[model samples]
Target: MMKRVLVFVFTSWAVLHVRAQSFSEVTNLLDSPTVGVFAVGTSIIDVNSDGLLDLYRFQGTFLQQPDGSFLESSGDIGFKNEDGSTAEGSTVFGAIFGDYDNDGYVDAFFEDLTAGSRLFRNRGDGSFYQANQETGIEIFSALQGSVWADFDNDGLLDLFVGGDGDPSGLFLNNGDDTFENASANVGYSPFRNVYGVAAADFDNDGDIDIYLSSCSQFAAASRNMLFRNDGQAGFTDIAPSLGLDDDRGGWAVVWADVNNDGWLDLFVANQPVSGAGIESRPGFNRMYINDGAGGFTDMAP
Candidate 1:
């Protein structure tokens, strides 16, 4: 029965005719002067609670109009610092939205490189106020990627931030509006040169495990790390037992049930570094099939 439906869909898709759509240049709609600036991170959310999705660039926020257009409104919405100034000459990498306070409104977190990270509490009226000082999650590091998950199973979202040179941190949510630094206590302090972070329950342990993609310029070799949750707040390094000890430079990572076996497999995107160009010798990506017994086998040849 499913095979007939699949054959019908394939035949219909093969015979369907579609026209290529053309997009018009609408650069003049945005009024912000820093539109062409180097934007590294972006997040789309209904910042105003007006049922319209808004765009958040590294420079500022853009509110969507009723006509499906965007207008820059960060300067008017109190996204500036306490001194009423904007961040300049700093690198912003990741932007994430969540209801950290459980106030029924989504807040924003912007990870910066030179300066510390920033968290903006949504005012529920289209405005926002910087709440990093009150939250205590701000850290001065070269931040790269941010991931949110309930690592402790406390019914609150915790934050995991990846960065360079002793910059990775795990901020455990205090269930209030604040967070506590739990990286060192949780056995994640040794990972210094992390770039990307992801969370999953690879062993089906009900608690989420962490995966970090790390690389360093000073080291001759680098490998990714996987930390299994200890059911407490601490973690145990399980990558070596899982046969993930490759010294390749890894960036992004994700997990999915690729083989329909109800076990989540791992995928790591790698890149070359230190005079190794793609044309000279390309770096191969990796995929690891989970053995459902707390181990992984590299399926990439």
Candidate 2:
């Protein structure tokens, strides 16, 4: 009886030791640490219908996180740390993912900050192929404001890009792996150095109009321009009459229905107002609220 009891005690001790080892292994995996490096993904959207907004971030590599917090993979490009050593080449900003090709997989449009931007068409089997070279979309050379909209009321989506001093590009989807450059035809050319752009059907004409923010510097002379869509390749500039010229070099503009009157109001953010003139406010900001009826009132000092 004594011998049997001793054998049982030894067996139990070994079992407990093995369990502890397994627990430690699991804990170590949970503590697996990695340093995040890039910040290109400035926009978020729901693509996979998983009820979570996936992260379309650029950290020298394209990273897709399902829950917006946890990373699933870095795609073909790898992740790199602070050290000079790299895992991926470069990435894009102003990125939006959607089924642009109707291939049932989300495609990517990212600004190549180091060079030109890129359009990456996703393969159905969890990989991506580059489309920038073939698409002729030059993202890096432009000034960096981009918004994707289905302009022209086409069944397919198109790209409306805004840049600084450089004319914006409109890569109209041809629906056949080709895009047409309609910037000049669309009245987006010869524009002053534009920074940010937003689109809305402001006049409620069943089509979207465009608003752009322009500034010489952060505080120098600047103007906010409005382009009203006249339905087929025609636009009119209505910024001056809209009282939007009262700007200390506008930086960002958005349309909001401030009075709940069903009409969209314009909101403009300008340079700091606490200074003497436009030069006084170095990095300060102001806002201009539109009162409708084609005029804007200053709401910020």
- Which candidate comes out best when scored by TM-score? 1
Give the range where candidate 2 is weakest over 10 consecutive residues by summed lDDT: 23-32
The residue-by-residue lDDT of candidate 1 on 1-301, one tens digit each, is 4654475466455545333455688656656665558766778889888899988877778898998778887777777555655642267777888887778888887777677777788888777888878989777777777788888899888888886765478899998888999988977676766777778877776789988876654333366788889876688877877777545677778887776566779998876655543222244788999988767888898
**Backbone atom clashes (below 3 Å) for every candidate:** 0, 7
How do all models score by TM-score? 0.80, 0.69
**lDDT tens string, model 2, 165-210?**
5566767778876677788786656675566677887766667788
Q: Whole-model Cα lDDT per candidate?
A: 0.75, 0.60
Q: Evaluate model 1: give its lDDT.
A: 0.75
Model 1 residue runs over 4 Å out of place are 1-36, 81-89, 218-221, 276-282
Q: After superposition, how far is residue 242 of candidate 1 from its true place, in Å?
A: 1.2
